[model samples]
Structures are given as C-alpha cells and as structure tokens.
Target: MKAVRIHQYGSIDNAALEEIPAPKLGLDEVLVQVEAASINPLDTKLISGDMKDYFPLTMPYTVGTDLSGTVVEAGLLAARWKQGDRVIARLEPGSSLNKHRGGAFAEFVVVPAQLLTTAPTKLDLATSAGLPTAAGTAWQALFETAHLKPGQTVLVHAGAGGVGSFAVQLAKYIGAHVISTASAANADLVHSLGADQVIDYRTEDFSVALRDVDVVLDTVGGETLSKSYQVLKPGGFLISIVMPPDQEQAEAHDITATFFGHRSHAARLDLISGLCDAGKLRVIVDRTFHLSDMQDGLAHSASRRARGKILLRPAV
Candidate 1:
C-alpha cells in the first residue's frame, strides 16, 4: 500500500508518498481500505513537530487522522463491523503516540473498532471524510463544552475555514443567532452557511462592532481571542480551540473561558452523520488531491485560506 509519511517531525516538506507495508490488525481493530482522508491543520502541526510535546510521534509516522472508508476485514473481537461496511473515523493522535502506527493517509489503515462510526447515508463517502475532525471539533466546542442554546448568540471567528464553517452551520442548526468573521470574499459563503451576521475581518473590527454575545467560538486566537472577551456578555462562555484562553482576562470579564483539545467521539460523529443525512448540515470542500499530491495539499492547508476542508484520495 502507498502512504504519505514523514520520516521525522520537522517540516511538511519531509512528507512523501512511499510504498509501505499494510498494517496488521489487532484483536480489537478493523482494517479499512481508505477511500478518502482529509488534511487538517493538526496534521500539519504534527508533521512540523509543533505538537510533539502533546502528541509525540515515532519516526516514519503516516500523516492524517480523519478518514472515510470501507471495511475490508475485522479482527477477532471487532465483529461489530464487517466486510464492505462504510465507516468514518478519527484516529486520535494521543492514542497512537509512541505506537508507530500508520494513520489515515494511506490506502489501508487499521482502526480500533470502537472508534468507528457509520458514515452518512446521504452523503458520499469521499465528502464524509471531511467530517470527523472539523465537524466533530465544532460540535464539541458549541454543544458539548459550552452547551450553547437556542436564541443565544454565538460569534464564530474564521467562519469560512474548516472548523469555522461547521461551527457556523451547527450553531445555526440549533437555532442560535450566529455571527462570524471572514474576508469580504467569503461573506456570502459564510452567510449561506447560516451565519446571521458576517463581519469582515479584513475591513471591520468585530470587537467594536459586536457586544453582548452569549458565546464566542474563537478559532483565531491571540489578538482575536483577547478581543473576544469583550464581545461576550457577562457570565457568557468563550471556547477557544486554537489555544488556551487567558484566565485573568476571563475572570475580569466575568465569563467562563476554556481551551479544549478535540477528542473523537463515535456518538458525536453519529449525530453529525444524521444531520448530513437529514440535509441539515454539509461539508464545504476547498479542494481534493490524490495521495501523490500530498505536498500541494499540505501547502494549501498551511496557507490557511481554504474555504473549507481539503480532501485526499488514495492514488489508484
């Protein structure tokens, strides 16, 4: 099987498509023939060694986490899944650290059976590959962590990007009044995704323009995160997926603040899959690249301008 891998954690340039042996199945794992995988900012960070402290990788690590595929075989104790079952899974990086296991960016991957979820019935498998990390993170932040409610207002920064796009749609699907920041070029796209108000980050200051928001989902940290504290109503919630929120600032603002690392939840992905089947959610694909074109895919993701998810299909 061919896989995109990094021999060492340093630069994405170090990633190359190479022929590698197929992974062996474990007693509690299933072997999946990958149809499509999505490149995430986290994947790039992992390859670049930026997250080595939290997710130490053994050398020659395959690159990717989120994938949708068909099951080819199951291990002794993993009979819940069977041959030809369509599945979506997020291989948690923390779970595989130091194990030297290959990831989703390959023609075949071994996944712990417990992590697998049925793919969306209505969406194509290739597109569903974009859901696990991006959609799951947004779902976790808004509903699981913050418990955002109907009629509440939430501000989502970088509304056109992967997590941001899903955040906007999910927030709106639950009847929250959604506000988002994006370039003017993406204003229409953000609004179409259900953002009630789209702030032009390039030309407008969100802090000065909006106030008394019920929740702020900060995808862009640092200055944007600092200013987000100002927009939230007193006692409101601020969830930052990018970095840790400032504790002192949260105290002064009289609001709850937290930074959460996204974890893969089969239940959450199940719900997201239902939403897709119901036509209540969608994946906005920025581009699709073959496994052989991984360098270009990584570069596009690193550029941080992709409108939504960047997908990778295994080379035939």
Candidate 2:
C-alpha cells in the first residue's frame, strides 16, 4: 500500500509516501479502500507533534483522520456493513492519535465499526471525506454542546472556516439567527452556507457589532473567544472548540462556558448523513490535493487562512 507517513515530526517536508503492508481488519473493524481523505488542523498538530500531551504517536505515523472510502472487506463483527458500501468515517485512533494504528492516507485503512458511517451520496466521495472532523465538530458544538434554539442568536467565529461553514448551516437549520466572522472575500461564502449576518473579522470587531447573543460557537481561541463572552446574553453559552473557556469570566457575565473535543458518535454521524442527503447540510471544500501532494495539502491547512475544508483525493 502507498501511504503518507511521518518520517519525522518536525515539519511537512519530513512526510513521505512509501510502500507499507496493508492493514488487516480487527474483529470489530472494517477495511476501507481509500477513495479520498481530508486534511484537518489536527493532522498538522500531529505532524508537529503538538498533540503529544493527549495523543502521542510513534516515530513513524500515517497522517490522515477523516476519509471517504469503499468497504473492501468487513470483519465478522461488522455485520451491518458489506463489501462495496461507500462510507465516510472519523478514523478515531486510526491515525496519529494512537501509536499502534496507521491511517486513511494509505491505499487502505482498517477502522473500528463504531466510527464508521455511510457517506452522503448526494456529494462526491472526495467532498464527503471533508465531513467527519469539521462537520461533526460543528454538529457536536451547536446541538449537543450549546443546544442552540430557534429564534436565538449565535455568533460563530471564523464563519468561513472548516467548522464554521458547517456551524452556520446547522445553526440556521435550528432556526437560530446566525452571525459569522470571516474576511470580506468570504462574506458571500458564509451567507450561502446560511449565516444570517457576516462580520468581516479582518475589518470589523464582532463584539462591537452585536450584543446579547444566545449562543456563541467559538472556533478560534484566545482573544476572539475571550471577547465573545461579552456579546452573549446573561444566560447564553459559549462553546469553544479549540480550548477551554474561562469559567470565572463566564460566570461574571452570567453565562455558561465549556470546551469541546469532538467524538464520532454513530448517532451523530447518522444524523449528519440525513441532513446532507436532504440538502440541509453542505460540505464546504476549499481545495483538494492528490495523495502524493499531501505535503502541499498540509501546508495549506497550516496556513490558517483556508476558506473551508481542505481535501485529499486518494484516487488521484
């Protein structure tokens, strides 16, 4: 199998595509023939070895986390899936997150049944590959974490970002008023994703433009998430995806604050599949790179200015 591996953790230049033996499925895992995969910030974090605190990888590590693929083989325990089924999964622990596992950057990957879900057939497999991490994170934050309600107001940081694009659509689907921050170039992009208001973060200060937001989904941490606490209603909540919110400050403002580390729940992925099929959810792909061009893809993701999800086509 041809796969991208981290010959070293220092930089993207250290990643290489090499031939390695194909992965064998465990009793409860499915072997997927990789069609496409997507790049996420976590991939970069793993490449730089920054997530070593929670997820320590061995010296050699394959680097993909989310992928859209076909079921080439299924374990006996994975009775629900069959060969030839198209799927998308957050290969939880199947990447650098766990030292023992390889990843979807390869020609094939074996992932646990728990993390597998049917891909949205409405979109191409390459685009569907972008959903697991970014879209799932947004879904977890907006509904499971924040519980955004209809007619309420939400301020999403980096609205044109990977998670932000999904957040805006999910918030609007919940019937909440959506306000998102992005560069002026992406205002229309966020609006098309269902955001009711778009604030040019580069040119406008969001805290100065809005007030009493019912929920704020903060994707960017530090100053942006800190300032977000001020614009929420007394009892509103702030859900930060990147880091933990300041509880003391949240209390002072009479609001709730929490952090999110997204999980790949079977139910959540099922729900996302339905939304995408019904056209209520859309996967946003800013760019795509071939499996051989993974280094370039990683560089683009690390650039911190991607308009939406960055993708990798395994078949290319």
Candidate 3:
C-alpha cells in the first residue's frame, strides 16, 4: 500500500511516501481500503513528538487517527460488517485497543470492528472521513460534558474551524442561541452554519460584547480560554478542548469547568450519521487533498484557522 510514514518524527517536510506491507488482520479487526482521512492537531503533535508521552511511536511510525473507507475484508469476530461495507472510524492513537495502521494516510487501514460505524448517506465516503474526530469532539463537549440546554446561550470560539463548525450547528439544533468568534471573512459562513451571531475576534472584544453565556466551548486555549469565564453565567460550564481550564478563574467566577478529550464510539458516530441523514447536521469541508499531498493538508490543520474540515483521500 502507498502510505506516508515518518522514518523519524520531526515535521511534515520530513515525511515520505513508501509502499508498506499490508496490515495483518486480527480476530476483531476489519481491513478497510481507506477512501480518505482528515488531518487533526493530534496528527501534527504526534509527528512532531509533542505527544510522545501519551503516544510513544516506534522509529518508523505512520500518523493518522481518522479513516473513512470501505471494508475489503472483515475478521470472523466482526459479524456485523462484511466486505464492501462503507464505514468510518475514530482510531485509538498508537494504542493497542485498535490495530488500525497509523496509516490512514494510505490506501488501507485495519480498524477494530468496535470502532467502525456505517457511513452517512448524506455525504460521500470521502467527505464522511472527516466527521469522526471533529464532530465527535463537539458532541462530547456540548451535550455530554456541558449539557447545554434549550433557550440558553452558548459561546463557541473559532466557529469556522472543524470542531467549532459542528458545535455551532449542534447548539442551534438543541435550541440554544449560538454565538461564534471568527474573522470577518468567516462571519457569513459561520452564520449560515447556524450561529445566531458571529463576532469577528479581530475586530471586537468578545467578552465585552456578550455577557452571562450559559456555556462556553473553548477551542482556543491560553488567553482565550482564560477570558471565557468572564462571559459565563454563574454556575455555567466552560468546556475546553485545547487545554485545561483555569481553575482559579472558574472558582472566582463561580463557573464550572471541564476539559474534554474526545472518545471514539461507534454508537456516537451513528447518532451523528442519523442527524446528517435527516438534514439536521452538516460537514463543512474547507479543502481536500490526495494522500500524496499529506504535508500541505497537515500544515493547514496546524494553522488552526481552516474554514472547515481538511480531507485527504488515500486512493489518489
């Protein structure tokens, strides 16, 4: 299979393409001919060795954690899936829980059957590839962790990026008035995605513009995450994805705080798929690249300013 691999982890410039051996099928694994995969910050961290403590990779490591593909073969233990079934999965990075090649940037990936979920009919398999990590992160943060309720108002940062786009739409679906921060260029785009109001972070101070939000979804950490508490209602929640929330600030503001790390669950993906099929959920794709163009796609994700999901098709 033609896949991108890091012979030595460093930067995107150091990655190279090679024909690697086909992955061995485990008893609970399914062989997927990956149609596409999307780059996330996690991929960048892994490649640069920033996450070595949690994801210790061997010298020659393949680096990708999301796959959208068709099942070319299934293990006997995977009775629910069969050859030619289209699916998507959120992989456990460098973890033993799944045998999926870090090679989602290649023509094939072997994911655990438990991680596989049927692809949404609303999106082609290629686009469906970007849904797992970004969408699931938004879902876990908003509904599972924050429990944002109807009639409440929520603030979502970087509304034009992967997770923020999903969070903007989901908050609207839940009947919450959604406000998002973005550049002036993305104002209309974020509004179209269901943001009740879009604040251009470059032009205005979001904290000065809004007060007493019911929930704040912080995709930008550091100072942005710190300032979020000032706008939340007392006892409101701050769900941070980029970094840990400031406990001292949260205490002073009388707001609850939690950092969300997305978990891969087929059941959760199914729910997202259902919403997409019903026309209630949508995937915003900023750009698409072939696996051969992996470097550019990854660099774009690292910018943290992409308009939407950046997809990489493997079988190019």
Q: Judged by lDDT, which candidate is best? A: 1
Better of 2 and 3 by lDDT: 3
- TM-score of every model versus the real structure: 0.98, 0.96, 0.97
Report the Cα lDDT for residue 53, model 2. 76
Which consecutive 10 residues in model 2 have the weakest lDDT in total? 93-102
Off by over 4 Å in 1: 96-102
- Global lDDT scores for all candidate models: 0.93, 0.86, 0.88
Alpha carbon lDDT at 129, candidate 3: 82
* All candidates in order of TM-score, best leading: 1, 3, 2
lDDT, candidate 3, 198-268, per-residue tens: 99999899989989899999998988887899999999999999898878989999999989668888899
**In model 2, how large is the Cα lDDT of residue 285?**
82
lDDT of 2 at 212: 86
RMSD of each: 1.3, 1.8, 1.2
- Angstrom error at residue 67, model 3: 1.4
lDDT of 2 by residue, 1-316 (tens): 8999996777888889999998877888889998889888888888887887767777788888888999998889998999999999887653443234438788888888878899888887778888888888998998888888899999989988899989999999989999999999999999998888899987889999899899999888999988998999999999999999998999999999999688767678878988999989988888989889999999998998898898887676
Compose the digit string of candidate 1's lDDT tens values, residues 119-190.
998999999999999999999999999999999999999999999999999999999999999999999999
lDDT at 316 for candidate 3?
58
